[model samples]
Target: MGRELLNFKMFLSVLFAFTVGYAIITYGRLVREEIGRYDRALSERVQVIERVKAKPITVKGLYLTASSAASSRTRQRIIELIKETELNSVIIDIKDYTGNILYDSDLDLVNQLDTERVVMREVKEIINEFHNADIYVVARQTVFQDPALAQAQPEWAITTEGGGLWRDYKGLSWVDPTKPEVWQYNFAVAREASKLGFDEINFDYVRFPSDGNIRTAVYANLEGSKAETMRKFFKTLDESLQRSRVYTSLDLFGMVLESGDFDLNIGQTLAVALDTVDYICPMTYPSHYPTGHLGLANPADHPYIVVSNGLKKSQTAFAKAERTQLRPWVQAFNLGAVYDGPKIRAQITAIEEADRTSGWMLWNASNNYDSRGLLPDEHAAALRSDVTT
Candidate 1:
């Protein structure tokens, strides 16, 4: 009987030892998982902090196309003109309204176009030269409405009701913004531009196809509101750019100033976009406005009044928001308006006259600018007299 009791006691001892071993193993796994979860949460929090601190260097610039005046002699003259005009900045078109890329883009599909004849091979050298002159370089990339990319990746392009790639008045098809893959493609391009040493990456046509068949167009994914999709695109680009430490800016329609309506079906909201970008350039070109705005007919004819009032409204709207800069794209092109040096001066003065803090960039499609028009006799005289004094 004593021997039987001894055997039972040994069995209980063995059972207790097994239970203790199991408890230790389970507790160790739980502790390891808890540590892993904490580590992931901490890593994500650090990333967020890093993004909030990202900012762009400030600049005052002019819009220029390297390919517009590709001749070496013209490029030299432009360099001299830029220095003479006291313009220390240039927004060169890396891409344009058309699907053509100005530089040699290694983007697998862009290479197949065989349109390499149109590129400015010395783009990197020119950019470096501009940097040497204390000039800021802004690489302008047009997104969303790339017919070139659409032709290459039709599966990624937006389609119309008739089951064809949607065409705008210019006969160009756009990449559907609703598709995240489309956003990824464009953002990848922007990232590459940033890596190439562009001081800032200015995304244009970052919205939906404005001139396309709006009514019949069908998004491949049809995910969210236009504004929401735009926000997602902007946020994705913004985050991607954060690691590169490059500044980002976007061009918004002038109408965004009046109504504050971002869903003008183009996915542009001033408030939401401004939060993620460094500078917000409202194409406040007076010529683009309707005949009557701010109770003025033919806003383009009166550059001073149009720019002044529009800037004043922008100043008010932006003042209540967070932004690093409020630069405005001034009119340098002849959009059916007789604009001369006096008119250009008026536009500059209007911006200055409003006491708003920002730089002004002149836009001329031909790459030919009337320097005389930009510097009126009065300002010239004032500059000379001040220098002598």
Candidate 2:
């Protein structure tokens, strides 16, 4: 009996040892898996933070449409222009007035909407090339003027009194600016652009429709005055984009600078823009100004006087703003007067003379820019170096 008891005790000891060993092994495996998951999540968060923290560049840029950027030949010519001239940046259309997304997007909603036109198939490669050339690239996104989105998601669109999609004078449909979903959609695009390595995201047409029959158009979600609603939108945009850490700019009508508190009934004001964005790009194209502007019979005819006077009028407000810088878009395409080298130079001179202004961007719809008004490559390089030093 004593021997039997001793053997039974030994067997029980062995069972306990095996059980303890198995439990330890299982626990260790679970702990390792948890640790691995934590590490991966932390790594991903770090990457996102790093990716979005691009420094703002002093941009002397030219606009390139999606078509121009997609065409290899045209893109090469534009790059050549940048290399030869003082141009250090290029604004490429990520989304245009047609509301077509120019690149393949990973977002499910974007895919579901079928908005990816894929004009720039090699978008990442293209951005890499620009980065290789030491050129900053900006993603231009047109919000609120998206006809495609309006068509795809009519509930989020501005409607006519007849319960149809409201069309602007150009017969283009627009999304309702008051819709939060629309805001999120645009923010998603901006985030994607940031991921794609754009140094900045420029929001254009961020306003209510201006050229349509205003009396007929209806906004179901509009909560306040046009300007107040717009201010809220700007605030939301700033907050949403802060996590991405990418530089943001808003394109405003140049008249906003001189208009003061008046929002032009399109819901944009210089004061609000200054408070919201890293940069405020007033579309100060002189041709767009009225004939009597600045006491000039034709404001576009005098590029220097128009730009200088407009910028000067806003200098006080710009000076007071702690954030944001003025970067006006000068006319490069001919409208009021033929824009030649001297004409372009005059606009540049005006920008340079303005206080609290950063740099200027040339606006030509054709993307046809030359070295006429721009400095030589070496001169611009030297100037940039001097500023940095």
Candidate 3:
């Protein structure tokens, strides 16, 4: 009877051990599968985050108008330049100087007040082509100098002390920067550009109108100094674009660099722009500088001197301000002096000497970058390698 009891005990022990082992194996398989699933999910989230992050972009670039971007042949020519040189970016006009949008937008305000500026057939596809080539695309929106908007909305325009629409020197009308409606109109365009995959949104003519009789102009809504008005506008714009996944830049007069207290009497100062925007672009074109600028006999004739001195001021001004980068505008057209490859490169060299990390841009109103070798071979090669690798 004792022997029989021992046999039964041994059988029970074996059966209990087998059951525990089977449960352990099953639990191990389930844990491994769950871990694998978590890793995959984490990886997908990482990719999505990367997509939303502002793209790493360098601004060795040229400017193209809306018309230029619409034409396949013109775009192809610029693409060839990008392929051949250190040029890896282009600023296309989403809102031209005339206050017209370049692409079709569904904004009700844009349709009811002013017409939509849709000239390109495949706007998004065009942007994709450039993006695929690793070219950074910046949407240039001409802000305060919208003639079309002013004409459509006369109530929002700068008024003469006599209550008529104030016109600039070019006979072009300007909208008041203080108007909240004006802010909404421009921000809506910026939102559209962000949605269309532009890496950057650059604001041109962000200040009050610089041209025409300043003494006679009357602003009914301006409650602060011109600088303060511009500052408020920029701050409002920055806040309004909170939902966008892009970088913002403001174009300022080159002289804006020389004075901390002055906004060229047009309502834009270096400090105010730096405080609010991601990038500050000084229109440092040598030809645009007046005679005796920076103590030069003719500033345009000495492109290097003008660019270097102007950039020095920019460097000093930016030294005090943190977070914003300086990207100066270099002349690409034949203006006061013949801007050849070397002359163009002289401005670029000046920019490098000032700050190598900051990028420089070229502007030719005619849409022609005749200086094919504007970028140095070594720099071009380095830029190309960066894209390829």
Best by TM-score: 2
Stretches of candidate 2 off by over 4 Å are 1-49, 379-389
Report the Cα lDDT for candidate 2.
Answer: 0.89
Once fitted onto the true fold, the runs of candidate 1 whose alpha carbons sit more than 4 angstroms away are 1-58, 107-118, 373-389
Which candidate's lDDT is highest?
Answer: 2
Candidate 1 — worst ten consecutive residues by lDDT sum?
49-58
Q: lDDT tens digits, residues 168-197, model 2?
A: 999999999889999999999999898888
| lDDT of the candidates, in the order given | 0.73, 0.89, 0.83
The TM-score obtained by model 2 is 0.87
Instruction: Give residue 100's error in model 3 in angstroms.
Output: 1.0
If both were scored by TM-score, which would come out higher, candidate 1 or candidate 3?
3
Candidate 1 lDDT over residue span 183-211, tens digit each: 77767677766656678888889898777
lDDT of 3 by residue, 115-156 (tens): 566787688888988988878989999988888888888888
- Rank the models by lDDT, top first: 2, 3, 1
